[model samples]
Target: MKKRYFIWFLTGFLMLNCSCNDWLDVNPRTEMKEEDMYQSEKGFKNVMNGIYIQLASKDLYGKNTSYYFPDLLAGYWYKTNNSTENYIMSYLYSNSYVENVIKTIWSKYYTVIAHINDLLENLDKTDVHFTNGNKELLYGEAYGLRAFLHLDVLRLFGPVPVGASDGTNAIPYVTELTRDPSKLVSVTYGEVKRMILEDLDRAEKYLAADPFMLGSMYDLNNPGGNGVNYTPDDDWHYYRQTHFNIYAVDATRARFYQWIGDKTQAEIYAKKVVGVKNTDETDKFVLATNSSYTSSEKGALVMASEHVFAVNCSDLQDIINGVMITSSSSRPKLYLQNAWISSVYENPESDNRSKGGRYFQTDGSYAYYLKYYESGTIAATDMVPLIRLAEMYLILIENSTLTEAREYFEIFRQARGMDFAISIGDETARKNQVEKEYRKDFWGEGQMFYYYKRQNKTSWSIPQSVTIPENGFVIPKPKGQSAFE
Candidate 1:
């Protein structure tokens, strides 16, 4: 969910047969032709679906990447976790392997940009007769999605702004259709942000309200944490992986504003989400009870009240009803870090109880719970959560004062069965505790890293611990010249 790589896709499309990272062959099908791709409604649908398939690759958002600090900050991953050591090694050391992934991600993101550029250019050229609502929404979605990818990468690699339009630089803005991305010069990060904001501004006008706007109990009570819930409304909507809507725009705005340090905009969108409270609990989105999902399952994407955006994972059903583990060291699968697992074991007891099994204990530490790949038999599990309803609530909590923090904190906490009523007056204490819960519940979900960077808090260290990274809370400019050297 953290990474938004489109490199495999770029290579697949460009090299035609070159094996880059992971993705299928790039040969054009008999049905596709340069001119015919946008000739009809079916062609349009086919193009969009292809975009989704490429976009949804594990590299893009399915698998986390270094260009994304949310994973780094979230503390869900560490340099020492056993199940994910190979993945963690290069990241911790900034080695060539991690660099290749970053390079691929950078390339793929631009490819996506190129593809969007082509779509927009061609779509703009066509005088298509369309049903009133469909064309606008679809194009708006296309723009929004394109902007989302562009903005996300910049957030991780661009430099901070200290002056005027001469802001810190960014990776090249791959906004034009091109066969040679390497020749492109990088643009200013501020410019990229400006364009992204502009796109979202257009998107804001075109997109509709949250799809799950109808009141439901599941929406109101969907947060799964104790002492202060975040994104309560997002919790209400539920549908595994699929298309994004207005909430996606809202959440992205909130997140983007938060990154640029525009707390007002952040708080505004955060509040807008909160205002859409869900009255009925039954409508809350959860794992489809007793239903096995396939690797191809688009995923039960978040509905209005459930989530804003999420990673469509290959769940266990692809491995035949959970008989085989999805994330093996070989083929691999999305997963929670062991530290993540270790932290969620909230009920480790000498005496066994129904809920006790949920908690894990290793000598002195508690554990976390993940329903995916637990027995090593889970060859397929599709539970990769990206941006959920809980995020907004946490954003609100972060927006609160010390006294106000406890008020909302208790509201969120009580929902998750934690009895601790928080009302701390210390700013430092409030930030720390709020962050702790955020880290604990939102781990494998992929929000941990940014929360840390946004608050100017410490980065992840070891389990049951935290450390402020000396690197500061800025995603440094891409390594160039001597740095990339």
Candidate 2:
């Protein structure tokens, strides 16, 4: 594990340069003893930040797990017939190209896990180095990240949750810091979910003092009645949204519960997040208002205010320029067919989330996803949104009684600039309404695929609906060493 994971290191000068917003931006390099490095507070921070940096790599959330590959899997992109993208849209796991992509995703996922394990193992010993409750923040972020990654892996590679038995072999829930391959073992899907929740339990406990919980009091500019004056000591604690803060943990719990066919538990966690308020009783995280997305600066394309947790990708502009954007030439892009875009956002002229809206840029026949749009003047624009406030409302819509579902969704709908209330006749109608919101709201976020999988849909819209095969929803684990591997 040590050999494979990025060796986290920071020079004295490098530590001098880190600021509140960019503390997590430093890359790992050089060889140093764990004892020597962990003796300082910055060293621990660099390691935690390094894990996030690696997660933003192309093999992970930076591309494959974010908007690119997963969206293709969900049939969001317009694929030419017989192209590799088309093959993926067809769920052709056995195709050589698709298989290799799967292998890379699997290997990279575990490699990052190895990095996380290293941090978790060394945390307890270095407790003395942290101050101002930073130690607990590190522990909380680490545990929450572990749960987040493992849950995503399970969602992609584990069995479809609709009818699968809990005791079936899912994937290895790796917690060990050891490099010895024999020590790892695969657990049942049920066990995996149990372990994920347990890690989240630790994360929530440790993050009780997280700055995000402080509401308006956490602002350095405001300082508030807590009697805590702003100082350099608080730098690392300021950017709570970019870290896996307390609300993010609850949001993850809500997501995981919904996945496991536990609607009651899902609603409980989702509601907890929905009810959160700040010192002044304002929403800690609110859904994006019309002006939030329509601002001339274009900084809030990813809906910055709503992000419960997001990764700040420093090279986000490079991704936008190189991979996602549309060009004059015929090279395929992450293009949303114009018709499909119109289909999803029924009120394209009125809905703020639509084609002529702030979220997309139309060229000829298709549109470019602008969630990760290039707007670097504001630092918040660089975020790769993972979890946000809107999903909590969507979760409630799925799990709550019909009247409650309508009420929750109406708030969400209004937030997205949709006027008029939905008249959902029954649970099925309510869910169908929720699906439309997910399709429009989560575009380019890599969530639509999971939403379809969780519903265990027999057929899905590749824009034009088609039947999904028995094994289509599951991506095969690499031609592996073992289930444990």
Candidate 3:
């Protein structure tokens, strides 16, 4: 029997808008062989762009990983009238609804990883010439994306790290394009960690010449920036932040290092991202100012300025509408409790991410997180933030000296409109304050659950007092997988 592969055929590939090179304007296309797909630079670009579109699908970051499932597990939303939300937020992983969600996440994530592996395999062996550093850009993005996807998989499915010797079995680190079942097997946590870091190292090396590192010509917020329009002559590297550019590489490194308790490496990479500068020495990625929270015309909700890596989800408005808004109140849906809103942002009047602020909308009984809502006025606002500059600062606060931590903390505080600062008395005080910040910072982004899991928190009190299960953090791998799956 002929063996089937996981690679999507070029006939099923995304149709390109050759008129302007805008990736978001994809349509259906005709068939081409795998060889023909990679015979030119545009083919490679299409494949890469297809992978991103897949990532932004509802099955992945666009809904589950970015906000819905993860945040529910983190206890961000109340179990309003939705039974599935109730089960997930309560950590009833064995429930059929929650189980289906887990199964889908596992299946979709690996499918995307397989596609990435196929792209890398073809990219390295092909003799096609790439112009203006596009080759390096593509290579870096592939490697970085592989690492990024695997790391998130590990975080979601792997055991919580205790130390270097925590030899528990973790998810498979798939690096090859094969449909063979025997090739897929779980490895130790340490092994997966090592593989992820190795890929990141390669990504960093290849991305060294990334346009983001070279100059600010691709700056999205700048007038006449390449992101403004994708002309036929324009290089595809203008929206560096939307891709896994070098700073994203560093930010991911910081996040992974922090996950493994490697404070030294974590701080090193965190500071690197924090220190990013433009050609004129202006801060390349800085904390969001108060205007970012108050400006209703812009995407004040998502805070694009601080985003290190964000996904341009074409379905963002749809996701927001499905989860947070509607014309009729007859449907039971996902929403935050009034208590959660008040508890997390205790000083609601002062904090821009609080109840009275633009980050949430109230209906007298419940609050809706507005971070993912689209403004329609700015094209840049329609995104799901995967990583942000504020998180880099939080990591520094977690790993830096008390004085240094306080400085970063104060800066972040002022940016969020807190405008208050106090000296930390000791390590314990610093740790407590950082935890509070985490609760306030990552409301709908799906990171609060990871924070709780990382800290091994057993009990929480935001919406109400509840004890987390010991195995709650370890999401079970879907069972009955065939070789192809």
Report, for all candidates in order, the number of backbone clashes. 68, 0, 1
Q: What TM-score does model 2 achieve against the real structure?
A: 0.88
Per-prediction TM-score to the true structure, in the order listed = 0.70, 0.88, 0.90
Model 1 lDDT tens row, 1-485: 12222333345254222122222222243213445556665455555555655554445554443213345444443344443344433233254555555556666666666667767666676666655354555566677777788776766555433322546566566656655535466677677788888887776666654333442323223345343223423321333224555656777787787777776787788667555543343333332211212132222222222455554444223421211122333322222343444344333122111123332212223232333333332232253545565666666677755565676666666544454344556877777666766655554445566565555555454343555444544443334422432
- Candidate 1 local lDDT, residue 81: 41
- State the weakest 10-residue window (summed lDDT) of model 3: 10-19
Evaluated against the true structure, the overall lDDT of model 1 is: 0.50
Name the better of 1 and 2 by lDDT.
2
lDDT of each: 0.50, 0.75, 0.75
Model 2 Cα lDDT, one tens digit per residue, 63-117: 7888877788777887778766778888888898888778778877777777678
lDDT: worst 10-residue window of model 2? 10-19
Off by over 4 Å in 1: 1-9, 12-32, 66-75, 78-94, 160-166, 180-184, 209-241, 277-305, 314-383, 402-404, 458-485
Pick by TM-score: 1 or 2, better one: 2
Question: Candidate 3, residue 416: CA error in Å?
Answer: 1.4
Residue-level lDDT of model 3, residues 97-209, one tens digit each, is: 98898888888788778778878988888888888888888889999999999999988988877543658778888999876676677778888888889989999999987
- Number of the top candidate by TM-score? 3
Pairs that collide, model 3: 11-31
